[model samples]
Target chain A: MKKILLPVLILALVIQLFVPSYMIWQRYDVLKSGTEVKFDIGLFDPYDAFRGRYVSIRVEDAIATSFVRGRYGILEIDENGFAKISRVESEPPKEGLYLISSEENYFSFPHNRYYMEETLAPEAEKVIGASAEAYITVRIKNGKSVISGMYIGDVPIEEYLTE
Target chain B: MRKEKWLLDEIEKWQTEEIISPESAEILKTRYAPKKKINLLIVLFSIIGTLFVGMGVVLVGAHNLWYKLPIAARTAIGFLPLVASQVLVLYVYLKKRDSIAFCEGAAILNMAGVFSSVAIVGQIFHLPSDFTNYILLCGVLALPSMLILNAIAPLGIYFWTVLNGGLCFDSLWETPLSTALYVVGALFAIYNFRAENGRAVYVAWISVISGFILVWVTSLLEDFDVFISLFAYFALLGSASVLWERAGRSLEISGTAGTLIVMLFATYEGWWLSSIKSDITIAVLTLAFLALAIGILIKKQRVVPAALAAFAALLLRAIWALVGLNSEPFSVVFMIVANVILLAVGVYYIWAGARKVSLLYANVGMITVCTLIIMRFFDSEMSLGIRGVVFILLGIGFLGFNSYLVRMRKKAKEEK
Candidate 1:
């Protein structure tokens, strides 16, 4: 039991450290290299027991007219520079960005949650939600998407709020 | 300290009275040697300090104080405590292995670090509030550290985490892999667990009662009434309570709680009149629980637990019969009878407890009767003022009975 203890602890430590590091690296990579686009969205307050408070992202425009279960949604920048689901396919676009959805109708996007400081989130949501030009800035690479920031009329929402 | 002093005094008395030799008395004294207060204080402060530090970091992250910092920096800071605690646990493992306080302290810090690492990352990266995923990841990763460090704190935390995972995830993590993860956890616990270690065994039993997800695993049964299925699942747990010492306490409490729930449902008219078809699982579990309860009654001479188990079995039978026959043999009289039986069971517990001179049994009986009566407040048409009076009366009665039992126990001990 004594001999095996250190090796097992190290193994667990590596996995534990690896998970969060990998997550950070993955998001970091996406934000650094991926195509940045805005998506017209609204927010409603929601609470997570572990992650604390956040605004739940609600995409404004129609995500998809038709969704196939276990298919990927290929998104394209519309005329207004807001991302819209252009097509659903079995394979992700060879050169462009795509989002995977295993469950039909529910389009899987990593940018569906915008976390904020505990007391600041609900107030931020109220301000950002009322704006006509409210959008979520997301960076997408390969298939991974990271929420860069929430915005109103090209100004970061945090700039408009009282800290 | 007090216990050690008392034991030493008792040993001296035994020696003077010539109950044992000086050598034997010396050995007894050595076994109960007083633990140093300073060492205990150090351990407590270390644990409390670590907790505060961890919570402070997480709270800072929650407030987005690190928002201005590069994500890399926030991530780095997050991993710092985790790395430090990982090393701390290893140090305890190699040097302070004999110290339970050290092991527990390391375990607590290690868990806090693990949580903060993930939480800060989640905070920095705007990770969605997928608590199920976050907690399960923490629990699964932290599980091995508990076994490696040989600490009860982590074991307790692991069990609680598994329970939360089951409840919060709903049917999301109910896949084969999640169940397999829990099975592996139990196996690891068994590997580390000694049957004699009271805390290890207690946590193990609680984990089985919750981690196995006997109740939540029925996500596949869409056609079945969840309430009827609860009877089957709870019957399964109730039978497990009689696993002869493995689940003796945890299962008894859990099984009794389940029985109470089903008993409450049985008192309702819709439960009997409704056309809910309970499957064969109910019958099988009811029989199993009945057999186990009867066995316990015969072997241990414990009547209340067996009686509660028997009541659960009867509920299962009536529910199961709804499948084959449209006749509602269980009626309003059955409702009255169920309430009466609950009251009777509580009274029986008090009687049996007093007869055995066991305060645990008597107190359990007292609480049982009090709880049963208090539960009736919602349905009873008593005014708020009257209910307050009843509450006061029950409180006084409880204190009076408790004092009487304490006096009797003291007298019996003195006589002995």
Candidate 2:
């Protein structure tokens, strides 16, 4: 019983570690190789008891009038990395970077929010709103996007807030 | 020991009744007497202490301490409780294998560790997944601990997590993944029933409730016809009752109660009359199924009178639907008859339980009756004051009925 129990315990621990580790590794890979895109967004801060502090953001040109239910919104990115909905498609794009949104009316970007220190979250929210040019940098690969960083004009939000 | 005393008393009674010889009674007493009782207070305190410690760890993890630390420190802090809890569980499994209290406590702590670790990882990394994914991750991570320790606490938490995860998404039945979560929950409930002691009834209830929600969600899908969904739901109830009768008493009751409630809903004219074609199809199918159920019960020679009455009411409503009885007066009469039949079933359960001296059944019956009565009171056009007065009266009546039972039991004891 002892021999069997030890192996099972080790296996459980390994799997538990593997889940979060694998999630992080996947996001890291996307950041490493994915094309970078920037979008101007409206931001607001909210406190979640479970997930701590984060700022919710809405992309400026991500809304669609001709929206279809249960279809992914196809987004076209310009040279400057700003994106607009080209059309809503039932299937994901065959190649290149495109924003895939689950919601029809609004873009449900995976990287819609930036998590931060509980105290600093409100400051980030304020900075995003106060700055004339507030945009978020995201790395998109194979229809998956991860928030790389947030910027107030040319400066990173973290650097701007810290200074 | 209290158990031994009870056994001894039962043996003495049998002896007085000449059901067993004096020597046989002595042998029975000797065989059944308990030996070497463990201190229950120690076990209880140990469980309570572990639970509080586990809750404390979760609270501390949730309290934004991660923000105060550097990235590497935050990651290490997130993993610390998880690794520590795993080690504790392993120690308990190897060293205190026979101690249920210790194993259960350790497993609970392990579950909390799993939840906190996943939550912290998600928060720190800003994982873009929804609550459903987090809940599923926590449930999966805690499954081994639940099975290894034969712990019901972790299993119960897993069940609740799946349930709330479904609610969080507002598409528990609609989403294939959420539906899969419900299936996983049912499987866990079954596993808990088989592995844990004295937990079959609770697990059975959970299983039936989960299945009901699944079927209801399937019914809400756009392409699925309503009549077919209703038929499928009724069939599910019937199959569950017949198949799980041997599993435990609660499964049968859950199925029967679920069927009765659905039939009661079917009787509401507003539910069926609005969609005439679908309504007629459902009414016809319901009648056929109720008839089939009644026939089976009669053939088995186990026909319950209250069940028969409920079925009869449903049958009448079905007939009324066929005849297109849309008059307000006729609908009111139909509703009253159905409700009265349901009330009769509750009363019958109460009377039968009291007569048979089963407190659990009696309480179940009393609750059913009380719930029905309260629902009726609220459904009526009675004033708030009148509703309050009726509720007070019902409470007093319950007390009086309990007092009567106690008096009757005392009389039986004196006679004996």
lDDT tens digits, residue span A26-74, model 2: 7777778988888778878886555667888777763543344435656
Best by TM-score: 1
Candidate 1 lDDT over B1-416, as tens digits, reads: 78789989999999999999999999998888886443656655666776677666556555655555677787788788789888888888889887766877787777878887888778777765567667778888777777766665566567556656655546423455565666666666554434444554566565655543545454233334555445544554555455546545565666666665566665554555556555465445445645665675567565446355445546654645654433455454455466666665567667878798978667766776776676656755335886688578867977998899899999999999
Query: lDDT of candidate 2 vs native?
Result: 0.67
**What total of clashing residue pairs does each candidate reach?**
0, 0
Off by over 4 Å in 2: A1-13, A62-97, A102-108, B2-64, B67-73, B164-184, B187-333, B346-416
Model 1 ranges with Cα > 4 A deviation: A44-55, A64-70, A78-81, A102-105, A116-131, A151-163, B1-52, B154-157, B172-174, B183-270, B279-304, B311-326, B329-351, B359-416
Pairs that collide, model 2: none
- Best model number under DockQ: 1
